[model samples]
Target: MTDKKQPRTPGAELPDHPKFLWDSPEPKRSYDVVIVGGGGHGLATAHYLVKNHGITNVAVVERGWLAGGNMARNTTIIRSNYLWDESAGIYEHALKLWEGLEDDLEYPILFSQRGVLNLAHTLQDVRDSRRRVEANKLNGVDAEWVDAATVKEICPLVNISADIRYPVLGATYQPRAGIAKHDYVAWGFARKAAEAGVHLIQDTEVTGFLTDGDRVTGIRTNRGDIAAGRVALAAAGHTSVLTDSLGIRVPIQSHPLQALVSELLEPVHPTVVMSNAVHVYVSQAHKGELVMGAGVDSYNGYGQRGAFHIIERQMAAAVELFPVFARAHLLRTWAGIVDVTPDASPIVGVTPYENLFLNCGWGTGGFKATPGLGEAYAHTVATGEPHPLIAPFSLDRFVTGRLVDEHGAAAVAH
Candidate 1:
């Protein structure tokens, strides 16, 4: 008999969800804090605001269905192996929070800490990987520079032969890196935030801002004007749409980043794998689907779908890296709009408007930073002062020339 195993029914063993997760509330006339965008970041911010600071008069406004934006479309790979100290500080904090998030949120997020291997294919890649490993270690993150043999041992499916176009020479391994169920994480945060009296307003688009002499008083939405003492923007790629009307120019550009998944099968892949030079990252979901993604498209757009050529390149790189994925049938493919910055680092601090705080420009790294960013951002909103963790990402860095440039230093190229 053939050694191949039979395929399981698709989505048969996925996590179960509650029938009614949260209440759909109409937007109040005013709130102590109004968060634009009800995705993972927005929900997490609301959750922390109530749990940590006892500020329950919060509202999360979503233009579409809850958590249906990038939160629903990402690859879900979470890691803290960044090169810069600021990035390491924030992402490592997020990883620690992720370790206990299920207990804290009182919900199952399916966070599998199976580790991540960022492959190095060239001499420069090897050098960069080794340096990043040292940087991660200095920042108190668990990272090591593993040779080709170690990489193969960690992920046997990886192709490290010399005949390939881009052979894997080595990699930087983070033992604590992993993936999570994106939707469940979002819903868990939403449930806890809603239970604490934060309003979950869906289908309410924020059309403009209500301003009073450089201070953003509230938001003007299609539903109605909702006044707020503080407004925090967590709207991923569409942040510029609202910021432009207020004549606040943030250095961000939107692009389409796509991802796809394979048909459900028995678990074969054991850990998350990413290759920056080849521009493909792979991880097998807890439900058995092989999830894969690549860098953003060349052009800038707000579209939620990418060009066919972009998907083609991504698949080509994936198949070359893991030959077993060649026969797997593609289940679905989609994209998310990502906001990239000049320094390739997130901007998370006060804006020109006194009452408005900006937390956008995460690009492909947003989902990994959900809880960490939320805790820091919530502190910024509650007290109108930037948290110590987020103080380096202030918008003024663009002018001060102290930017945290992670253009090629990050694990993935945005």
Candidate 2:
């Protein structure tokens, strides 16, 4: 008999009621706060704005189904270890929120603390991992340096190659880092936000923003025009389209990032393993399938479908690190667009516009940072000032040369 536990066939269509549909209707043309994205960030911002700030006049406008963008297209890796204190502190807060998300939202997010190990395959990798450990500790995060022997003890299945192109040396372990249910995160936030009086309008696309001088008045959507006192641009990949309509340019690039999953098998990976040199990472899902991902496309394109070469390179690196995956059959692959910034950090807080707020350029690291981003972006929207956690990631920093470079730590995982 076929196993009932196996995942449905690839590309299987589920009943389409539009996931997490809000009960509210769109106002004719007015809202206190109009958010231009219905992804995790936008929904979470609405949640915080109502629950924390007591500001509930919000409407999250989306062009498609809620979370049909990067929020639903991430690999769900959550970690706080970083080579800089700024990122470490903010992501640590995000992890804390994730730890309590189920209780706060009264929704099952299924956050799994499987641990995340940043593997070091060379002396430079080891040194960088050590520096990240120190930086995380200084930021009051739980991070430590684990040598090769400890790594082997923790994950015996990993290849302990000495003569390989990138020899295994050591790793940095963050016990608090792991994965969470991505769709549940979006649904939970959307549910609570909608219950709190925020209108989530999917199938409603914001085509352009209505601005008067340097201040934004409202947004013009394909559905209809909506007036607002303030607007927050939480749209990840399409941030430029909205910003450009307002005659402002942000230093962001859109790239396609791909991830794949293998057929169900006996669980092997107990922790997330990241290889900087190989530019690949792997972890086993709760369903016993191996989920793996790699860097973005080499060339910029709006196409979400990536070439086979990216997955081929990822499979090769995965097999090199964990030979057991050699026999596993690939199940399916998908890609999402990422808005990458120059320093690979996010852009939060107010932009050059008076009433237009921005929370984009998260690159590939936005999923784990959703909670903190929501909190900080909500604070910025309400008070018109950057939250202390997000102060280091202001957009002007790119122009003023105060960039928070987390490249040493973010190159692999962020």
How many clashes in each structure? 0, 0
Task: Identify the candidate with maximal TM-score.
Answer: 1
Model 2 alpha-carbon drift over 4 Å, by segment: 1-21
Residue pairs in collision within model 2: none
TM-score of each: 0.96, 0.94
Worst 10 residues of 1 by lDDT: 1-10
RMSD, candidate 2, Å: 4.9
lDDT (tens digit, per residue) of candidate 2 on 266-376: 766777889988788998776677889988776776677757989899899988888878999999999998888888888888888898998888888999998888988
Query: Cα-based RMSD of the predictions, in order?
Result: 4.3, 4.9
lDDT of all the models against the reference?
0.89, 0.83
